[model samples]
Target: MRRGLKISLVTLTGAALTLSASACGGKKAETGGGGDDKKTLKVGLAFDIGGRGDQSFNDSAAAGLDRVKKDLNIQTEEISAKPDEPDADKESRLRLLATKGYNPIIGVGFAYTNSINKVAKAFPNTKFLVVDADQCKVEGTNVLGACFSEEQGSFLVGAAAALKSKTGTIGFIGGVNVPLIHKFQAGYEAGAKAAKPGIKVLPAKYLTEPPNFDGFKNPALGTEAAKGQLDKNADVIYHAAGGAGIGVINTVGAAKKLAIGVDSDQYNLPAVAPVKEQILTSMVKRVDLSVFDFVESVSKGTFQAGTKKYDLSNDGVGYATSGGKVDDIKAKLDQFKADIVSGKIKVPTK
Candidate 1:
């Protein structure tokens, strides 16, 4: 029934888009200027790490673009960043999009901070949105920074692991040893101990450090990390690693252990169909929401520059229960979510 409801909603959304387009002379048009000026809106996306098919972060962003194209009848261009690509390369990618008259080009990950910063200055009239990058540092610019509270969602999943662990030990695999990933680690550790005092949370491991972002794309590294943790008697494991997380899920499923997914509802992904049962839950970061919201704002000509944040109260971050594997713990997770939103519980980002 839930799946049917979701499909119905999507159908309605598409119908609304079609209706709107028909009202505008058979196709929706961008109207940035006043008085009878009609132009087609073109948006561009620069994906992070594993790109669109990784079934994770990049896929989430792609979902947003798909919605914008269908609902708003907008044109979009998407490009993927190379593994360990330099800032200059990223800048060039954004620049290419802007030169082609794509307004409001977006960068999908924090790694694009330098690139977006550089490119935004070059294209003053073009609006830019950088996901997961610090907006405070870019305070006086024509760019918008869209940030999320990943720690809050990670905490919920971490607590779930503690309640469900048979061995009373769990593990975490991070994509990089940066502060962003650390926010995930800190919240997981805190929530595990909060749920079950004295429970053993295994040490966290990072596949690589900054300037070497292969960790986000290397499944081999993720599999290796998960194996090490599983060998240490961890019954459940969670990963904030991007594309590499695919390997983690595969490894855990092959071993018949539980694994937590990140960024998206990974259990629903076709790439993980064979091991769907292994995903206990996922820390859904809502990148799709952020991307879609920005596109909507641009379309309405209310596009604002500066920072925008997504958090627990805004449905920005939370855990997924797609496989019904976490049904027994649903009530407990709900309480945690309310507590975080109501300020009774403060999930750490450090």
Candidate 2:
């Protein structure tokens, strides 16, 4: 179970009020001592846009940090990226955490690739981890790149969409036009074609172009894009957008059509509880596992540099079966997964 944003408001004199909020971006409450042998570990997480309550990508990363605090008894600090902030802001965020002695700092998205590389080189002793980026593959560097085979997971959900669609038309919506989201689109198209060669998949829709990443956070954009696809008779749609994907699900579900989620199981997410039944499945990218494993390695004194890959073989990415929506086709989806894992079917990432 993942946690969402928690807000609290306090009343003051004369109808004035104060608001104190705690969430993934908040400083975690310190835990008790471990012992003389247990060295206190401090982790810093820089969340991508949409932050914790996103119910998708960022929340998955936060789940990893939550586990680190619980199992390792460590102090953690989290900072979120602001909408359309400059690269300097990201650098400053990383440097601030490093200066505060947060070792093995993590940047939760590919947007931090350059920032992590620059910061890790300066602070050679403090390790860094960047999700969805492979810039840390240089030898002797103190940074680890956690990359996932997102296309493989997207492939499974794409096949599910093809198998379940009654109208023979499916669609894809991406938050950004970046290469990362391209992988999702490519795999989805490939999988859908493999399942039903005659199935009609609409042209991929993107909410925003590069350098304007509001696509990942803007629900209104998602709503508009999804409505447009629905108007075209797309009965099944898959979205790789982050928080914006909520709009895609809501619009599709309200139309009595099916939608596929990404990153986390949207069916179980509190954000989409109203439309749980409409979510056919999710491309579950295990960002939480990758983040937790990196921190665990650091804690165990076995942290290593270079890229660590997650794919169907290691449960790094796959399709979710929440809401029993995909249960009827689980065997077929599993077969597709097995074929990909066994190198019989290669998923595209372009």
RMSD of each: 6.7, 7.0
Residues 1-350 of candidate 1 have per-residue lDDT tens digits of 00100111122222211123122553445422211224346677888877778778888888898898878777676777676768888887787677766776889998888788888888877778888885334543568888888889899999999999999999999988888899889888878888888789998999998878888878899999999999999989999998889889989988999999999999977667788898999999999988999877766667787888888899899999888989999998899889989999988888
What does the lDDT read for residue 153 in candidate 2?
94
What TM-scores do the predictions have? 0.89, 0.89
Give the candidate number with the greatest lDDT: 2
Q: How many residue pairs clash in each candidate?
A: 0, 0
lDDT of the structure predicted as candidate 2: 0.83
Off by over 4 Å in 2: 1-38, 134-140
lDDT of 2 by residue, 1-350 (tens): 32344221111111211111122233332221112123345677888988888889999999898887777666667767888878788898788777666676899899888888888777887878998884324333688899989999999999999999999999999999988999999999999999889999999999999799989988889999999999999999999999999999999989999999999888877767788899999999999998899877876567778899999999999988878988998998899999999999999999
Model 1 vs truth, CA RMSD? 6.7
Worst 10 residues of 2 by lDDT: 11-20
TM-score of 1: 0.89
Cα deviation of 327 in candidate 2 (Å)?
A: 0.8
